[model samples]
Target chain A: MIELNHVTKTYPGASQPAVDSVSLTIPEGEICVFIGPSGCGKTTLMRLTNRLIPITSGSISVDGKDIMGLDPIELRRHIGYAIQQVGLFPHMTVRDNIATVPKLLGWARTKIDARVDELLTLVNLEPGTFRDRYPRQLSGGQAQRVGVARAMAADPPIMLMDEPFGAIDPINREVLQDEFLRIQDKLKKTIIFVTHDINEAIKMGQRIALLKEGRLIQTGLPDELLNRPADEFVKSFVGADRVLKRLNLLKVRDAMMTNPVHCRSEDSSEKVLEQMVKNDLAFLIVTDRDQRLLGYVNQYDLRGHKGHAGDVARKLTLTVSPERNLKEALSQMLSYDLGILVVVGEDGRIQGVLNSTTLCSLVGSTYDEHGGHWGRITAAGRIL
Target chain B: MTTYDFIVRNWPELMSLAWQHTVFVSIALAIAIATGVPLGVYLTFNRRLADTVLYLAGIMMTVPSVALFGLMIPVLSVFGHGIGTVPAVIALVLYSQLPILRSTYAAIRSVDPAIIEAGLGIGMTRAQVLFKVQIPMSLGVIFSGVRVAVVMSIGIGAIAAYIGAGGLGQYIFNGITQTYDAMINAGAVAVSAMAILADFMFGRLERTLVSKGLRRD
Candidate 1:
């Protein structure tokens, strides 16, 4: 665990302290994100944890020991540090760069080489192809991956990341974020992530600490901050579209309706149409005996057909995994003009159905419980 | 006689002078590199001191080769080593300092700050960062500086012959007084050829010394 007790930093000759007295505890195996606008001391606060910037007053303890008591070099070696610039050594090959800390600690040559290959594979870069390549040979995304690998070389229990994905293009940034999260899931390293982007904070952070003007204004889970903002500043910072943002935090399984009305594809069209009518639905999901989604049968297609439901069922081109966030499911639905998406399990079995109504109600109910103007807006939409 | 014919006829004489010239420049370069490179690196951490030292080196470079060689003789006469290889070497070493020191300082300074920060952040000591990171990264640039010093030293070493230091410059001084066009041509040609050869060899050395990753090609 990392704990801060009234930590503050005032640079030499600076009139105001860059980081004001702020105390927070980040539990082991959790990601605590430091987020704020530019020059808000979010970066400074992270630097203090690693002693990259010495604290002017107060104390920071890592793993229950006062960091000031530890040699700064020894302390830093045990903490992984990654930055937006992706500071890779140009003169060294990827293997050498990643081996830096291990070599410093005098690891056996064979062990360092093995660890280098292992790290490259972990970041999804093929070890054989990238091991001997230099940083100059890597693309921006590849370089950032190498930077991350180098930071994690020694397998430091705690990592300090300052906008690790900030330099990548939006498309690749999301990929790196997901990849990092996947690695973090298995490693469960205590991480302090710093970013200025709020959407990233919600996605990567298990808990977010909001800062403004060098002082932490509020800290809580993404849902807590979105649902119950501490004050007007936080409410505005979280933005007006926070309701939509909250969908990013929820999984498809959370909003999907289970036991959706479905019929076997081998059933007669008349039978499928009867099922749709009896359920008061215009469309019926068609599935095989294995419970795998084959397609859907609509009233228009079913009325004129006189064969097995499978023959007339329109092919289901879109399906979502239960593990994907509701935001992604929502986008797929909106982009394809889909009213409902089949939630499929790993075995290709149809586990549930997520419709626009269920998704809206899921978000709407949360807003209603919070007693906000958004709840009234969603309610009026129900009339339409 | 044509320069080529003169070179062939006095090949033995020219070869000896060329060897002497190479020796004088080589000794001077070794000393300059040893002292100048470290001083250049040290100056990076002390900007105020770097300014004063680089300025003095620059002023030394502006001194004419012959005049500087002349000054070296007087200064070294007190040590009973006037008008020979020692004074010539002292003058050449002084002349080579500016390029070697300036390039070393600039090369190290030009290294990406982010790379250095990454090194330190990863728990390297300041000295380790300099040796393992800054120095290796700056090798290409520093070599170019050494290359410049080499070409300059060769040219100036020829002038050292005027102060009685034996080299290809002797032919030029003798040929000018004797009005022997063939002798002067041989000396000038050999000196220019030597400079070009040194440059080419150093270029090859740089490619071998610097990491392939840092090479632009």
Candidate 2:
């Protein structure tokens, strides 16, 4: 457990403290992220966790012991750290760099080699391809991964990361973040991750502590924090566009328009139109035995066909998973040149329809005053 | 018609003397690096003593090469020392300090604090972090300084022949006294070659080692 008991820090020239007298406890195995706007002390708090910057007043403790009293080197040994600007030694190869910590502890050559190999695998690096390579031989993301492997080498229970993924490209950042989250689950290490992006915190953090100008403004789970932000700063920092971010998190079942008007591919246009009109929907999803969307039919497509609904329903060109990121649904609609998308289960059963209006509405309501309080169904069926 | 032909005809003599000049420079540089790099490292770490150290190095830098020899004469006279390769090599060594010191200071100071924290955080002691992390990271810059030092050492090594420090400088100084242009030209060209060779060798070493981790593959 990591605890900050009224910790505060003031730089020589700055008038105010970087970290105010605020207390917080991060339980073991929980990924607690500190997030805020620029210069909001989120970075300062992470710096304090590792004693990178000295605190002007108050104390921080690890596992109920005063961190200041402990030998700084010994304390750091059990706390892994990585930063946005990865500073892998330019002269050392990937293998030697990862083994740096183990070497310091005077581990045997064989032990360090084994640990380096283990870290290379853990960080998803190909040992054969990357081990003998120097820092210059690796790309930005690869170097950062090496940084993580080096940090985790000592297997420190507490990990402090300051905007670790901030330097990578968007696609790479997403890939790395997902991989890192997976690693965290297995390690169960208490992590104090710092970031300026709320969406990242929500996606990766088990709990989040939001700070503003050196003060702790709010701290809660993603759902709790989103539903009810503590104050204006919290609301604004999480921002009004959060619903778009939430779309990535929400299950298709939660956002899907269930009981979609259904028709068989062999159904005639006239009959499909009747069902579409009855359901007040222009489109009817055509399904097979397993409810797979073989096709779809719009009321407009029903004008000429005179037989059963099955005769006119066109085959669906695309299908989506119920658990897929909702953004895919929006993209699927645009890609298929259709006004709606079909949500399918793992068994290929059509779960429901995703209309453009609903997708737009889901992405737009991030402005809601109470977000994480989503347990209370609002008038729009939006979680408050 | 060409000096290259003249040198070829006098190849045996010129080659032997060129070997001597290389020896003179190598010894001088080894001494300078041994003394200068450590002093610079110490001065950089100790804030209070930095001004005094800089002032001392500054005074040494401003002392004219020839005047320094004259000044050392009396001191050596009292100590009863001979005036040959030792005194001349000592002068060249003193001249190589500024680049060595500046680079040593810059390389250490410029290392990112975060990388150092990561090293220590990984359980490395202060010494290990310095040698393993800080030093290697700064190798590019530090070696560049070493390159500069090597260039200056070779170039100045020719000057030591003034005090009978056996080297190529003797040819130049002797040629000047006798107004023999061949000796002066030969000495000047040989010194330039040494400087270029030293620079090229160190540059390649820097790229292979220090720069390997700095450049993205």
Candidate 3:
């Protein structure tokens, strides 16, 4: 864990501190995102943790040891750091950049070579394709990946990332974020991430610490801040879409209804229609014996049918994975004008169903769980 | 007599003068690089002295080379090193500093701050950052500076013959006094050939020495 106790940093001649007396703790294996407007000292706070800039007062400790007592060079080698610029050395090949810390630690030639290849694989870059290529040869997204790979060169237990994906295009940023999250799950390195983007904080952070004018305003889980902002500053910072943003943190499985009324593909159309009628439903899902989704049969399609339900079943063009976020599912539903969506597992087996009503109730219950009194009052007001 | 005949007749003498010329410029350029590069690097750390020192080197360059050689004669006489090769070399060394120093200073300063920050952030000590990051990145620019100095020194070294330093310049000065057009032609042609050769060699050296990562082509 990295702990900051009343840590403050005042520039030599500045009137106020860049990072005021802020106290926070980033527990091990969690990404604590520091987010605020520019000049809010979010970046300064990250620098202080690595001793990139000296603190004016207070103390910082890493894993129960004071960082000040450790040699800065020794400290840095053990703590990986990546920045917005992706400041890759232009003179070195990608392999060399990633090998920097290992070489510094005096690892043998074969070991460093293997480590470089291993890290390249971890970052999804082919060693044969990228090892000899220079930084200039890479696109912005690739360079950032290499930058991240280089930081993790020595497998440091902690990492400081300042908007690592900030320079990437939106589509690419989401991809890198998901891939990084997948990697973080496996590595479980303690991380302190900095970004001015709230959406990124929601997506990347396990806990979000919001800052304002060099002071810590609130630090909590992403859902916590979205459901209950500490003040107007944070509310506005999280934007008016907090309700929708909160959905991004939830998976389709979290709100899915299990044991949905579905008919096997070989079932008679009459039998399928009877089942749909029994459930008071307008449509019936057709599945194989293994419960794999084949399609759906609607009442209109079954009106004059006298064959197997599979004969008239139309393919469900839009389907979401159980692991996908609700926000994506919501958008998928809206774009397709779907009132209901089928959730499937990796093998295409129908796991459950998510409908609009169930999604809304999940949102409303999330509001209630977080003591979102205003949200509930508004919901009640709307109902009335 | 034809210039070719003049060259063949005086081939041994010409080779000796050419060898002497190469030695004088090579030694002077070596001294200049040894002193100037360090000064330029130091100024990067001490910005207060940079403008003053660079301005001084710039002023030193404005003085005509022939006049600088004359000025060096009396100054060095005080140190018991008056005239000839010593004075010629002293003048050449001073003349060479501007390009070498300015290039080193500019190259080092132009290195991206982000790259330096990355180096330090990655746990390299200050010296390691300078030697490994700063120096390697600045090399192409620094070498270009050295190239300019080399070409400039070759041209200036010829004028050193006015102070009794032997070179192809010996042929030109002797030809001027004796009114021998062939000797002057031979001297002028040989000196121009030497300068071109030096420039081409340095170009090849730059390709060999500079990091392939830095090359555009």
Candidate 4:
């Protein structure tokens, strides 16, 4: 675990401290993300952990050892670091660069080679394709992957990444972010990630520290932060789409309406009508044992069918993944002109149906009267 | 022997003398680059003295190379020297400083502050950030400055011929008074070739320095 006890940093000749007296405890193996607007000390706080800048007062320690007392090189060796530009050593080839920290620690040549190969595989890069190439040979996203691999070279328990994917194009950023998440799950390393993007913090951070103008605003898990922000600064910082960003964390299991009424394609229309009437639901969601949605049959589509509601069932365009973001579901609902979308598992098996009301209910109890920033919900269920 | 044959036979003599001018200019450029890069970097952290120091460099740059060489003669004479190649080298070095200093200062000053922030955020020391991040990123621009300095020093060193400092310029100056095209062409070709080679090498160095590729900033 990393702990900061009232640490502060003031650049020489600056009018104000860049980072004020702030205390924090980051648990081991948790992804702790620092987030805020520019000049808010989020970056400064991260810098202090690595002793990139000297503290004006107080102390910061990791794993019960004072970081300040450790040699900066010695301290950094134990911490993996990746930055926005990647800063891969241009003078070195990719294999040699990724093997940097291990070499520094005097690992055997074969051991370093094996470790480099493992890291490349871990970050989803083809070792054979990238090993001999220089950093210049890779694209922005590829370079960042190599950067992360280099950082993980010695298998440091603590990793510090500052906007590692920020410079990548949006599409590539999403790819790298997903890949990084999978790697993090497998590694379970203590990570401190810094970014100006609150969305990134929401999606990537196991815990987020929100800072503003050199002050610690709030630090909490993603859900707790949205459900109970410390103040107005955090609410606004969370942005108008805070509700949507929060939805990304909620699974279809958490948000879906379970035990939905079903009708089979072979069942008679009269049979489906009785079932819909008995269930008091507007539609009978049809599915096979595998739960692959054939279509949904509403009261209107059922009237003309000779067979059961399944025969007249209006084919659903597509199903959403159980892990898909709530905002995406809302978009699909509008695009398909349907009140509900079937939730599917990785194998396209229907988990449940999620309508507008069910999703909102699943998210949280409305506290609009408490006078929060999200005063309206015009974007379907989004409290914009 | 034909005129061309005689010249080609004596080519070693001409090139050997011209090689001294190349050595003289190369030394001057080395001194300028070594001194100028730090002065430029110091300007970044020591902002208060930036303009004043830069203005002094500008003044030094403004002096006519020939007049500056002449002025250096007495200074060198007092310092156990004479009106010869030493004065010429001092003048050429002064002429070379402006481009290196200007480019280094401009390139580093314009570097995206975001890149530096990212560097520090990831645990790199300030020295590491400057040398590893900032300096390397600014290299393409800095290479342009070094190119200017090298070319200027080499071209200007040819003026040392006036002080009787032996060089390729000797042939060209001699050819001018005596109307010998062979000598003038010889010096001009060597001078142009040196400039082209310096430009090409620095250009390639710029590409190698950018291992991370062109950053968004």
TM-score for all models, in order of appearance: 0.89, 0.80, 0.90, 0.75
Model 3, first chain, TM-score of 0.85
Candidate 4, chain B, TM-score (2 decimals): 0.88
Question: How large is the i-RMS for each model, in angstroms?
Answer: 0.7, 2.3, 0.7, 4.3
RMSD of 3: 4.6
Predicted candidate 1 versus true structure: per-residue lDDT over A177-287, tens digit per residue: 999999999999999999999999999999999999889999999988887889999999999988889899989988777766677877888876775665567777788
**Which lDDT tens digits does candidate 3 get at residues A1-384?**
999999999999999899899999999999999999999999999988888888899999999999999999999889998999998988899999999989988899999999999999998899999999998899999999999999999999999999999999999999999899999999999999999999999999999999998999999999889988999999999999888888999999887776676888788887667656655668777888898999998988887789998899999868899999999999999998998899889998988888887788777644465323321111110000
Kindly indicate the candidate among 1 and 3 with the higher DockQ: 3
Off by over 4 Å in 1: A258-320, A336-353, A365-384
Candidate 4 residue runs with Cα over 4 Å from true position: A10-18, A85-117, A131-138, A257-357, A364-384, B1-16, B19-57, B78-80, B83-155, B168-217
Best by TM-score: 3
- Distance (Å) between predicted and true CA of B205, model 2? 6.3
Per-residue CA lDDT of model 2 for A152-271, tens digit only, reads 987888888888898999899999999999998899999999888787898888899988889888888886676577877777777786556667666676666765657665555665
Q: Taking the tens digit of each residue's C-alpha lDDT, what string does model 4 give over B61-115?
A: 8887778877787778897666766777777778877888889998889877755
Summing lDDT over every window of 10 consecutive residues in candidate 4 chain A, give the lowest-scoring window.
A375-384
Model 1 over residues B158-187: C-alpha lDDT tens digits?
A: 999988899999999999999999899889
Report DockQ per prediction, comma-separated: 0.70, 0.47, 0.73, 0.17
Better lDDT candidate (1, 2): 1
lDDT: worst 10-residue window of model 2 chain A: A375-384
Which residue pairs collide, candidate 1? none
Score residue A212 of candidate 1 by CA lDDT: 90
Say which docking band candidate 1 falls in. medium
What stretches of model 3 exceed 4 Å from their correct place? A258-319, A344-352, A364-366, A370-384
Off by over 4 Å in 2: A256-319, A330-343, A349-384, B1-25, B47-59, B112-114, B154-158, B164-168, B179-211, B214-217
